[model samples]
Target chain A: MKSALSTLLQQTADLRQAIRHKSHTGVTSGLVQGAMQGNVVILPADWANEFLLFCQKNPVSCPLIGVSEVGRYDMPELGHDIDMRHDIPEYYVYRDGVKVESRSDIEDIWQDDMVAFVLGCSFSFENALSQAGLTPRNVEEAVNVSMFETNIETVPAGRFFGNTVVTMRPYTPKDAIRAIQITTRFPKAHGAPLHFGSPQDIGISDLSKPDYGDAVTINDKEVPVFWACGVTPQVAIRNAKPPICITHAPGKMLVTDILDTALAVL
Target chain B: MKSALSTLLQQTADLRQAIRHKSHTGVTSGLVQGAMQGNVVILPADWANEFLLFCQKNPVSCPLIGVSEVGRYDMPELGHDIDMRHDIPEYYVYRDGVKVESRSDIEDIWQDDMVAFVLGCSFSFENALSQAGLTPRNVEEAVNVSMFETNIETVPAGRFFGNTVVTMRPYTPKDAIRAIQITTRFPKAHGAPLHFGSPQDIGISDLSKPDYGDAVTINDKEVPVFWACGVTPQVAIRNAKPPICITHAPGKMLVTDILDTALAVL
Candidate 1:
């Protein structure tokens, strides 16, 4: 008999097929149960090396999983026929580090000098946390996870330098402990939180107002647990100001064929 | 040339010598830096089988490490010449399930039908917690750990049936999470905490007043974290009401020759 995870993959393969036909283009968070979802960043050949260095410098914020050679849209390591231009839900086009356009696909924008990099996402650890009986509040609410800009600085690489972006998950002290234990197992998916209690300590001013994504409910006892977000690279990319760049829209990740457990350090 | 752990052991050996001589019959909380100190429970042969079943039933609270043969009075597996009578600096004598006396030694009460059981203590996990930068508060305050009786009852074995006794360590939500991760690695040392957060949620009425030991200061930002303590077995022993029972009194544990690292499951 097929395992439940195998069943999740069978359904995910069908969903990916729909995505391939451009009939389904949305956030892929709950689509694949056990497969790894990734944040996508595309840059020109001249800027790719520096961005790769940026990811290497700040692994917790931007854990680089697959780096495609310049002008190569094919990602054989991540999946079969995984075209960079059309596999994702949405794309954010950046010119001189400023977001210029948002599109469902990037076929026409694909450039020969462009190189694609796949980064491990916080969502990779979400499954682990849930499995450990610390289901994140955002998952229960069925919303985009609350994210914020933190005072914690990311390591600089050439022109790339900015404060990190962090995803927030509110948990009671007990659940938060379980969450920490769960997340620590996945080092590639941002090993552990930068800070947990009193968001102000990490320079987050307001709990009600988030920098990105849909906000979820925080119970009276729940404290916001902040994890280094994959969106951190977009902030760094903005600081670098490459003439032309493309990335998966925040929260709309590139769902890959890789298993989430494969990314766990232990 | 010697490793720091080896040097630390040399110092611990010195402390153990003092402990053995009844010259240092105090809490062994911080005495031997990294040695595997244990909770000692000695019972008459007629009751030893029942206590062994209790340990087997409630492995977390009473993690059985070494169980000696009846009338053996020695534990080569734990250490050379670990006499149940003289090894533990302080011993608690229970008659009809009541703690009747506290003694520095139990040589006079030693019996030919007695068997000693060495159980893993939370101190083993505390060492791991401290090394991971989540030092338990009890160790830092230099006091006997604050312990509480919980509503959560342990599985019964023979005549033994009682609720668990847990030790509390206060930490901010973040550190609590890290502590959970650190402690999970030492299942032999009570593994992960049974509960945390609101004390009343687990039938703990007041944080200030404890059932046993000293209460340490808990900052407003910190939440009390509780783990299944070594003291749980004493409560079980009290409930079992064997005509006579003996255990290492409070924090004055049996300092074994075994290394703490040797007990680490991971």
Candidate 2:
């Protein structure tokens, strides 16, 4: 008989294996219930230093969970037997600030001078939110969380500079308040939302149209709560015009063995 | 040379002394800045039991900081040499749910069977908010917080039943998020807000007019955030129709020696 913790860990490892072998190649949103998922960003050693400074300057938007050594794909700090090159369900290749290709495995393109960075994702906190009975609308609708580019600017580090990208979740004011308290506990996963209520207030002119990801229904009684999105770094990378870069595709992410509770801070 | 804590304690003691001697009859909103303040409620021993149950039923609005034993006026746990009859800056006397008189001291009316209850006030969290640079509008304007009667009802306990009262503070969405995290630390002082945004959603028809306190300015970019108020219990007691009830006038609270940080949990 496996302990509950052991079973959850085993399940997470099994799911990662499926993703590693290309058996599970869809969005990783609702899979492996308690495990933490990460947004993948791989950069050449030269670009990695400036990107690290960008993350330090804008921590709320880019909470780095693990940074692999140059040329190494394994992020042992975040998971067991993790291979960043083959673990993520989907990957996107960027050349000179433009997204040029999307693929499943990055093993063929892996470079000795590249460094892998795993960032804490909002998906990790969704489980905690759902367990608190404040299930986010994106989870209920079974679609990607709505992402919008806000006028709020991110701090510049070297050439990395761009407006912030936020993920919105519609909730009633009462439920939103509880959501704020619950999410504030996970600072590594974007902490609490940057804004709530009117979309225009945050320079998001249209709730129906988003800059990235799929938009969910916003009921009449619900107000949109916006959290700083991990996609923000990608926008900065485009502005920085790094020569070569690779990242996980929009909904797909790397499943790590770390439990969601491990990301919580006081 | 006195320590900073010693000076704050002396200042609080002197202020309480002034309030006790009938020298200070106005509101206690901004005075004795670092100490905990409480809403005063006095009732006969028979009514105290039901009121206690009511406090338990609605702890957010009626956080019990201290309760005097029957016939006792001093709350030693809350402060040294505290006399409930004279500690509050001003007192309201109610007879069968109706206002009878307003007085500076209740020493003459203090009955042998009366029990004095001290409930936590939101003023304590104002210091925490101000320290975080999210100075509440009421503090900035030097006025009582804008309080309103909401449609949200409290849990019924015996005859004590009425709508929950809430205090409003206006802030930009960003500041409100920080305020929420800062105030959540002090659970005994109403924790986080009950709601934010549209006033009408919580039964408040106007932001310019409040039922209990003076309304502060709501800038074009700001949204009004509402927190459960200590006055809620007073409304409950009024509905209960206690034969003889004494309470602190709105904004005039019992200044206790306990530090504001003492109420913080996590």
Candidate 3:
């Protein structure tokens, strides 16, 4: 008789295998519900040190969870048999700071000088919020979480610098407080929110037209709560103008064997 | 050489002694800064059990920290040699749920059937907020915290039932988020706020006219934050119409030896 834990492990392994074989190329949000899903950033070794410093300086936006050794694809610390080159469902390839192509697998472009950085994503805490009976509207509506580019600037590190990007989730003031408490436990997944009320306070003008991802409903009684997002580091990478950079497509992620609860601070 | 702990102990004892002797009969808001101060409720033995159940049902508003044995004036668990009959700066005496007199000591009225209830007060968390550099406006202005009776009803128990009463403080949205996180650490001291933003949302009509305590300045950028107040139980007791009841005068709390941080959840 297979226990629930063993079943979950097998399911995670099967999903990763499907991704590796180019058979499951879709957004990883809401998939493998309790596992830690991450934002992928593959940079050449020459630029990896600067990116690492950027993450340390702006931890709320770029919470680094697992960083692979130079030229290695396996993140053993993050998962069992996780291969960075083919594990993410979709990948965005960039050249000289501009996104040039999207691919299901980056095995052909895997460089000897590449270093893979897996960052903690908001999906981990979103799962926690759902478990606490405060499901984010994006998940309830079965759509992508809303993302916005803000005027709030990230601290500069080496050649990396840009304004922060944030993801928005709407909740009534009562539920927002509970969500804040729940998310505060997952520091690796952006911890608590950066702002809650008026979007203009953070320089976001329109809530309806987001810079990325589809907009979810914000009811009359609900206030939009904004969190520092994983997309922030991608914007910084663009500003740095690295010759080559790769990232998981927005909403698409690399699912790990690590349990989401494992990232909680308390 | 007196260590800091011993010094704090001496100061708390000195303050209590002063209050006991009627030398210090003012509000205890900022006095004995880091020590725990509590709201007081004295009820006849017949009604004590119902009030006890009320506190249990509404823990956030009436977080019971210590209760004296019936007919006993001393609360050893709250402080060394603490005398509830005289340690508070001022007492409000009620006859059939109406406040009839104010006195420095209740020795003449103290009955063998009276039971003294000490509830955790917001002063503990307000001190913590000040320490975290988010000074609550009431503390800054050296005034009692503004409190309002909200439409949010408390869970009724026996004859005790009334709408929740909340204390208000003003802060910018950013500071309010930080305040929420800081105050969440002290569950016994009202924990996190009950509501934030518009006054009308929680049934507060005007910010300037508080049901109890003086109103402090709410700057243009600040949003009013509300917490479940210790005064809540007094309102419930009023509704219950106990024949004879006593409480600390508004802002006049019973100073205890326990450190404010002693009640923090994390």
Candidate 4:
């Protein structure tokens, strides 16, 4: 009989292959359950070092799970035969600062000077939360996790600086407390929530219309709990106005073979 | 030179001695800083088993730290040369579920058929919070922590049954998240909070008027964070209406030699 982990790894590998072939170009949330998914950032080598410092300075917002060698597309440490250029289901192209277009593959624009960075995503903890029966509202509603720009400032590094971006999940106080504890275990995946209750306190004027991704239902008796999000780097990158950059489209991630449980600390 | 742990232990011993001699008949909060403080409950042997079951059923609210042998006032596991009859600054006496009077010492009322229980108190985590620079509002305002009777029910065990009581501390959303992480390490100290935000959701009608203890200032941006409290068991004891029962007065806890940090789990 095949071991559960091996079966999971095989499933994840198959999913990645499907994504790479453009046969599965859609939001990757909830796909390949138990596997780790990463937020992609492809930048020129000239800009990579400063971006690395930004990640280190604001680890809660951009927890770097894997970084490819300059000009390399494969992150061996993150997965087997993972091609950064095509593994993500969808890619968002940014020129100067603004997002230009979304594509299934970035192979045409892939550069020899590009450095690929894979960041740990909150989707890892979502699996743990669902197993614990504290399914997030986004998962329950089958929509993109709500992402918003907050007034909270991120530590600046070189040209990388902007207000942090956050993902909001509405949970009742009881379940929110449990969610906090569960997510705290996955520090590399943004750790515990940054805030809960009163979105306006974080300068999120509206929860119904997020800066990125679809807003889910915030039921009565539930307070919006906010986690530092990986998309924060994209905002910083826009502020920096790098000549060119590539990132995974919101809700579409680069799936890896690493087990989500492997990210838990203590 | 004495090690820090030994020095703390010695200081705790001296503090206990002071309380035993009636030289210090006041709340034990912030006294002997790193040592543990416990909620005291003395009941006849007949009712001890039921209370034990009650603690087990609701471990978050009544985390059992030490229990004395029937007919004994000494709890060696809790402290060296401990005398439960007098170590607490003040004790509340009850008969038929009614609080009759308060006493400096229980020596005159100590019965040969009595059993002493020392349940963990939330003060154990206050030191941690303060060290993290997130001093609880009660500590800053120099008042007892605001506590309320919540509608949340605890599992009933025999005669002991009642709603859970919770202690509240107001903090900005950021600090509350950190507080949640810090307190979660000490399961014996009520672990993580039961709720944060609207008090009415948990049956707390007014933040200004707590059912027990003084209400501290809830700053404009701060939300009240609630933790399961040791006082919960006292409420249960009242509902049970045991023939005779005794407990430490609110804020007047039994100082033990155990370090507060020692109770933290990974």
Candidate 5:
């Protein structure tokens, strides 16, 4: 049974490889469905300890899944022979937390002192929601999910803290409640919502002008439900002003062999 | 350990008895604090089946914890020997789901074919919320919790179907989200909130004119938080229009011996 499950999961890895080969490079949203995907954060060893503590303090924002040995390119626990450099369709390099460049791989920039932290992503629960008959609108529209920054404070760690960044999904109050319940089962994926209803309540001035990703239509009867974004710790990293940091560009996630059901608490 | 827990629970029984004796007959707020108290519903066996199905369909509203066998009044699991006739400080006798009269006890009205259902009450979570340092304003002010009937529909079960009734507590949208997280852990006590923010969205035109219970303050910065109510099934019972039914008067509930921990999912 384990081998059978593993065989099915390898197919997911094969699909991710296809996406990596530019055969399926476009957002990787619906491909390899039902597998848990992760947001990648790689940083120098000097800032790695502080960033680990930051994720511990602000778990809702950065749920850490696997941490690689210093300078190690292999994230064996995340997937079989997962290469951090080329697996992601895109990458972001930040200097002092400001985006400096984008690349398809970082083999040349790879350093022995760098540590890769695999944080859980909302795409995990997005799959669960869709399976439960509440398909997320962003998935239906074939767009990157909207992202926003909220005033809600994250627990501060040494030189690593910022307000939580949240991803927005429009849901009717009824659907929003169900979404809250469904997302809660996957705590590693920014469990539950940080806020719902008015944008003003969370220091958000407008729904249309999102800080990152495209804003989808929020129907009149629906409210924009907010979940702590996987990118939140990235914001914290930016504020921390690390010498060098790398991340999977938004919407380009690290597909893992883990099944979404493996994370359910209930 | 069982005996020790039971010994601790005896204190609650003592307080409940004191309330019945008029030695402790206020709102029962903060009385016997940690013990699980329940909303009481009593009905003739003929109407009991439908009401049972209603509670089954509307678990958030009428979470049936212990059901007394027809023609019996004992609930050993809830208490050592809880006498339904005079145990509660208050009681409301409903004829056809419309409350007709109330009394301290109904030994005279107690029927041979009557069955009793005791549901986990919101007070269980009030204790939890208070401990978490988010005690509601109504509890702080020593007033009845405000309740409203909503346009949200309940799953229909035979003749027992009506829009859900919800209790209102005011909190900023951010805090309301926390409350939803906290209360979602207690499914026996209504689970997460049904709606928040707009009263009109759920077909409630006025927040001030609550259909049941007293209205409380809703500050400007705060959004009105709503949860499924213990009284929701009572409203459905009214719609069902049974020949006879009895329930604990509003704010009055059956004191049970069960520890609140018994109901917690996590």
Candidate 6:
């Protein structure tokens, strides 16, 4: 009889295998249960150092979990048998800052000097929130979390610079307080929230119209709690205009074997 | 040469001596810096058990740090040579649920059946917040923290039952997040805030007119963050209509030798 932990691990590995074979090429949100799913960023070696500095300076927005050596496709620290080129369910190919194409795999365009960076995503904490009975609205609604661009600027590093991007989830004050405590444990997954209450305070004028992803209902008694989104790095990369860059498509991520609870800090 | 820790200890002892001698009879807010200051409650032996159960059931509003034996005036666990009858700067004496008189000391009225309770107060965490550069508005203005009676009910114990009382501090969303994290470390000091943002959500009608203590300014960009107040037990005692009840006057706390940092959980 397999334990629950072993069952989760088997399911995670199976999902990754399915993604690798291009048999599962859809949004990875709420998939693989307790396993970590990360945002993918692939840049040429010439641009990798600057991007690393960006992540270091703006840790809440871009929490770098695993960085592949130049031209390497595996991230052994994040998971066993993880292949950067094909593990993600879907990939976005960007040319000179503008997204040019979406593909099931990036193996054909994978460069020798390409470096893959895996950033810790909010999915880890979202799973924790659900287990704690505070399910994120996006997960409950089966939609992408609402992502918005804010006036809050990121600390610039070389050519990588842009305003922050945040994901919003509506929760009542009581539930929001508990959510803050629960998420504060996962610093690798953006940790706590950057702001709550008035959306306009952070330059988000309209919660109904998000810059990316579908907007969920913000009830009369609920206030929107905003966390620094993994999409923030993608916005910075777009501004930097690296001649060629690769990223996971919105809501699509690289599933890893690491347990989400393993990211919690004291 | 005395170490910094020794100096603080000496200062705390000296301040307590001043308070005990009636040389200082003002609010203890922001006084004795890093030392723990507590909400004082004195009740007869017949009612002490009920109140103790109340504190146990409603730990946030009445966090029990030290409770003196029946008919005892000394609280050695809280501070060296501490006299509960005179250590607090001021005292409020309630007769059959109604506040009858306020005095600098309660030595004349001390009874053989009396027990003293010292509850954890927000001043401990407020000192920590100030040290972290998030000085509470009440401390900055040298005013008592605003406290309100909320609709949130405490878990009942015997005859002691009433709605919770909460203290308010205003901060912008960003600062409130940091405040929540900082205060969560001090569970004895009411832990994290009970509510933030909308005042009506917690049954607070007017920010300008607090039920107890002086109201502090709430800035334009700020939202009021509230913590379960130490005054809650007083309200419960009032409703219970005990033959006699004694407590520290609003903002007049019993200064203890316990270091505020010692209460931090993690």
Residues B61-160 of candidate 6: C-alpha lDDT, one tens digit per residue: 9999999988989998988899988888889999999999998999999999999999999999998899889999999999999999999999999998
Restricting to chain A, the TM-score for each candidate equals: 0.95, 0.97, 0.98, 0.98, 0.94, 0.97
lDDT per residue as tens, model 6, A135-174: 9999999998999999999999999999999999999988
Angstrom error of the Cα, residue A182, model 2: value is: 1.0
Better of 1 and 5 by TM-score: 5
Query: How badly does each model clash, as a count of residue pairs?
Result: 0, 0, 0, 0, 1, 0
lDDT tens digits by residue: candidate 4, A151-175 = 9999999999999999999999889
**Model 6 regions lying over 4 Å from their true place:** none
Worst 10 residues of 4 chain A by lDDT: A24-33
Q: B75-170 in candidate 4: lDDT tens per residue?
A: 999889999888999899999999999999989989999999999999999999999999988888888999899999999999999999999999
Tens digits of per-residue lDDT, candidate 1, B126-151, equal 77788888777888888988889998
Q: Which stretches of candidate 4 lie over 4 Å from their true place?
A: none
Q: What digit string (tens of lDDT, one per residue) describes model 5 on residues A1-266?
A: 57867776878789668756757555666667778889899999989998899899888889999999998888988788788877888889999888899888888999889999999889989988998788988998989998888888888888887888899999887778778788888899888888888788788999999898888988888888899888887778788888899998888888888886777666
B1-266: candidate 5 lDDT, tens digit per residue:
46867676778778767866767554665667778888888888988888888888889888889899998888887887688877788787778767888778788989999998998788788888888878887788787787788888999888888888888888876677667778888999888888877888887888778786667887878888788888787778888888778777666677777777677788
Off by over 4 Å in 2: none
Ten contiguous residues with the weakest lDDT in model 3 chain B: B232-241
Residue range A92-185, candidate 3, lDDT tens digits: 9999999999999999999999999989999999889998999999899998899999999999999999999999999888898888899999
For candidate 5 chain A, the 10 contiguous residues with the lowest summed lDDT are A22-31
Chain B TM-scores across candidates: 0.95, 0.98, 0.98, 0.98, 0.92, 0.98
Q: Lowest summed lDDT over 10 consecutive residues: which window, candidate 2 chain A?
A: A249-258
Model 3 in CAPRI terms: which quality? medium
Candidate 6: residue pairs that collide: none
Judge candidate 4 at residue B153 and give its lDDT.
98
TM-score of every model? 0.89, 0.98, 0.98, 0.98, 0.91, 0.98
Better of 2 and 4 by lDDT: 4
Q: Every model's DockQ, to 2 decimals?
A: 0.41, 0.81, 0.69, 0.88, 0.59, 0.78
| lDDT computed for candidate 6 | 0.92
